[model samples]
Target: MKATTRKIRDADATKARILAAAKSEFARVGLGGARVDEIAERAQANKRMIYHYFGGKEDLFKVVLEEAYLDIRNAEQALALDHLSPREALETLVRFTWQYYLDNPEFITLVNSANLHRGRHLEGSERLRVASRRFVEMVRDILERGAGEGTFRTGVDPVQLNITIAAIGYYYLTNRFTGAVMFERDYMSEDALEQRLAFNIDTVMRLVLA
Candidate 1:
């Protein structure tokens, strides 16, 4: 029994390692550029193990993206929206979303890469689509409630608002390569980034609440 339990634990650890490595590779190189051999090397596992656990490169990519989405969803879920006032809820959502992207920089890259390819790789994944819609619905509920309480403007389309908020956060992280060249400065500097976040939150609040 002990030996069987040990094997199960080892299997779980190996799967975790593979997922982590796959996420990094996909983020760096996108779905098209990511290589299974490199992911195998990074995970310290044989290439065959990746196929054994995750089927192939495409499957691994899907899993990695799903994991990234799940992380953001889980963080948003922990915001305790019911306990906070309408304005506070919006602020908390904005702050949490910003921090999530900042901490998980790889997520931004993975998403941007997928989007660049028109989400072809992710189009087949119904679970991912559902999860995404659920998050959108959560944001919509918050906005609707705020509007009802007069804390937010009426006729604000939640989907549009969510996309705008995402654009603000994602552009800051994903546009680093282009922004550096276009803006003539380091876009990743601490002070500048904080200012950008503040600007984003303020802009969102002004639009939705004022």
Candidate 2:
């Protein structure tokens, strides 16, 4: 029994290692450029083991995309914005979204890769869509609460609002190089990032606030 248990634990660990390695591989080169041999080497596992775990390169790519989406959705769920006042919840959501993008830029790259594939990989991910609904519902609830309290304008489209908040932060970081050159400023600098953070908060809040 002990030996069986140990074997199961080892298998789980190996699978996790493969997944971690695969995520990095896919993020760096995307699906078209990513190769299985390199992923196996990085995971310290054989190609046979990777195939046993995930079937093929395309299957592995789909799993990676699902996991990435699930991770972001799980983080948003963890915020439990419902417990806070509407205004505070919106602020927290904006800040969390900004920080998540900043800390995990790999996610941005992975998503862009998926888009490049015309969302073919993501279309196979029912789990991610289910996970995403929780966030959508949360945003809708927050908007309703804010409207009820007369703290925000009524008839706001939660989806559009959510997109706006994410876009404001995502665009700034993702396009920082171009923005910096065009505006002649250091967007990644400590002071500049802080300024951007303040700007994101102020601009989002003012847009929604009544």
Candidate 3:
């Protein structure tokens, strides 16, 4: 039993290492440019181990993307929306999303690279799409409940509102360097970023609840 447990622990460690290496590779070189050899070296695992654990490069990439999506979705689920008023829920979601982008810059890079290829590399990603849809549905339900209870404005499409919220958070991170150049200052500066996040939450509230 001890031997089995040790083997399982080692396997888990190896899997974690591979995932970390894959994320770095995908972030730096993107899907088309990333090499399996480099990922193997970075993970300190042999090529066969990677294939054994995650099939091939494309499959591994898909797993990494799905893992990122799941991370955000899990965080959203953990927000305890039942305790917050509709406006507050919106604020929490926005803040969570903003912080997520800041913390998961690698996710941003991976997503940007996928978009650059027109998402061709993300074909057969129905599971990921379903997870995203669940998150969107959660937002929609919150809006509906809020409006029904007179806590939010009527006539707003939850899908559109959610998209707008995502845009406000994602656009800033996606264009941080360009924003810095355009604005003649660091867009990611501590105070500046927090101010932007606050402004975004306020803007959404104004549009949705005012």
Candidate 4:
């Protein structure tokens, strides 16, 4: 039993390292440019171990992508937005979304890579689909609550609201470099980010508020 436990622990640790390394590699160069050999070196695991655990590169990427989405969804769940007032809940969501993107820039790149392949990697990912459905339901609940309280407009689509909330932050941060050059301003400066967050909150509130 002791030996079995140790073996399982060691295997779990190795798998974690591989996942971390693969995330970094895939985020850095995307799926098409990422290499399994580099991932193995970065993880400090034997090459065969990766194949043994994850099957192949594409399969590994799928797992990594699923993990990424799950991370955000789990964090959102932990926010307990359901307890807050509808308006507060929506604002909190916008704030959380923006901050999350800022803190996890790699998530943006991984998403872009997935989009580049037209979400082929995400196909058949029931896990991701379930998480996304829950997220949409969360927003729908908020909208329904607000409408019931006469604090927000009725008939708003939760899916559209969710997309807008993500887009407001995602587009800005992902385009910070080109946007800075194009707009001739620093989108990532402390003040700029603060202003953007404020704008996002206001935008979302206006869309939902009665």
The prediction achieving the highest lDDT against the true structure is 4
lDDT of 2: 0.91
- TM-score for candidate 1, please give it: 0.90
lDDT of 3 by residue, 121-204 (tens): 567778778877888778888888889888888888877887788799888888888888888988878999879988998889
Sort by TM-score, top down from the best: 4, 2, 3, 1
The regions of model 1 sitting more than 4 angstroms off are none
TM-score of each: 0.90, 0.97, 0.91, 0.98
Alpha carbon RMSD to native, model 4: 0.7
lDDT string for model 2 (1-210, tens) is 999999999999989999999999999999989999999999999999999989999999998899998999999999989999999999999899888998998899898898899999888677887887878899999999999999999988888988898899888987999998899999999998888889999998888888
Which tens-of-lDDT digit does each residue in 16-122 have in candidate 4?
Answer: 99999999999999988999999999999988999999999999999999999999998998899999999989999999999999999999999999999999898
Range of the 10 consecutive residues with the lowest summed lDDT in candidate 1 = 119-128
What TM-score quantifies how close candidate 4 is to the native fold? 0.98
lDDT of all predictions: 0.85, 0.91, 0.86, 0.94
- Model 1, 70-106: lDDT tens digits are 7787777777786787788888888888888888889
* Error of model 4, residue 80, in angstroms: 0.6
